[model samples]
Target: DQQVKQNSPSLSVQEGRISILNCDYTNSMFDYFLWYKKYPAEGPTFLISISSIKDKNEDGRFTVFLNKSAKHLSLHIVPSQPGDSAVYFCAASQTNRDDKIIFGKGTRLHILP
Candidate 1:
């Protein structure tokens, strides 16, 4: 079973609009939620992160939220830009358990002109 899942395979948002990507995980032991962005030719890079102890974390135009009870998390990008188009992946890890990180299927975000 996939511990982490991205329900939406793709999402499109107009320029200057908010882009929200959702993720769900089954493991209650997960302590960290991470969002990664992958360009066409580059490996996925860390975008944002939220710890289980906190409900939300924000960086510039990017924000990450974690809902422990719902076993869900989301990444939000404000004023989506064309340059923001990329494949986004949601990941979860139990830092106390081991080094293994579970990744979602990923969602392709299209920033429309």
Candidate 2:
């Protein structure tokens, strides 16, 4: 079984609108949740993150929310821009265990201009 899961294969949104991506995890040991954006022919770049101690974390237009009880997490982008279109991966790590992180398959987001 996959430790991290992104049920949605892809998402489409209009520019200047909001984009939401969902993810789930089976591991309760995960204390840190992160969102990474990846472009073609490039590695994933960190976008936002939330620690288990906090329910939400935000940075500029990007925000990440974590529901530990439900083992669910989500990333929200406000005023989505065309430049934001990319594959987003949800990752989780148990800091106490090791530095290794588990990542979801990823969801492709398309921004319509």
Candidate 3:
């Protein structure tokens, strides 16, 4: 069973538009969720995160919304730019300890210029 899954392997959007990436999880024990962005061969960089207790968190052009009841989460990038083209990974983990994280394969976002 995939504890975390990103059904869409890729997404495309035109510049200045909205881009939304989705993620689903089956593990109820996961209490912390994070979104990371990666470009080329670089490691993923943390974009945003939300604790299970919270439903939403935002940082500049990025926003993450968690629906605990549905076990679903999404990352929204507004006014998507060409520079936003990269792979995005959704990760979840149990909080308060040194626990390993479960990550979706990733979604490749292509922003058309």
Per residue, candidate 3 scores C-alpha lDDT tens digits across 66-95 of 999999999999989999999999999998
- Return the TM-score for candidate 3, rounded to 2 decimals: 0.95
Candidate 2 lDDT by residue in tens digits, 9-48: 9999999999999999999999999999999999999998
Least well predicted 10-residue stretch by lDDT in candidate 2: 94-103
Off by over 4 Å in 1: none
**Model 3 local distance difference test score:** 0.95
- Per-residue lDDT of 5 in model 3: 98
TM-score for predicted model 1 compared with the true structure: 0.97
Query: Candidate 2: where are CA atoms >4 Å away?
Result: none
In angstroms, how far off is 24's CA in candidate 3? 0.2
In order, the Cα lDDT scores of the candidates are: 0.95, 0.96, 0.95
- How big is the RMSD of model 3? 1.0
Q: What would the TM-scores of all predictions be?
A: 0.97, 0.97, 0.95
Q: What is the per-residue lDDT of model 1 for residues 42-105, given as tens digits with 9 covering 90 to 100? A: 9999999888999999999999989999999999999899999999999999999856988999
Error of 2 at 61 (Å): 0.3
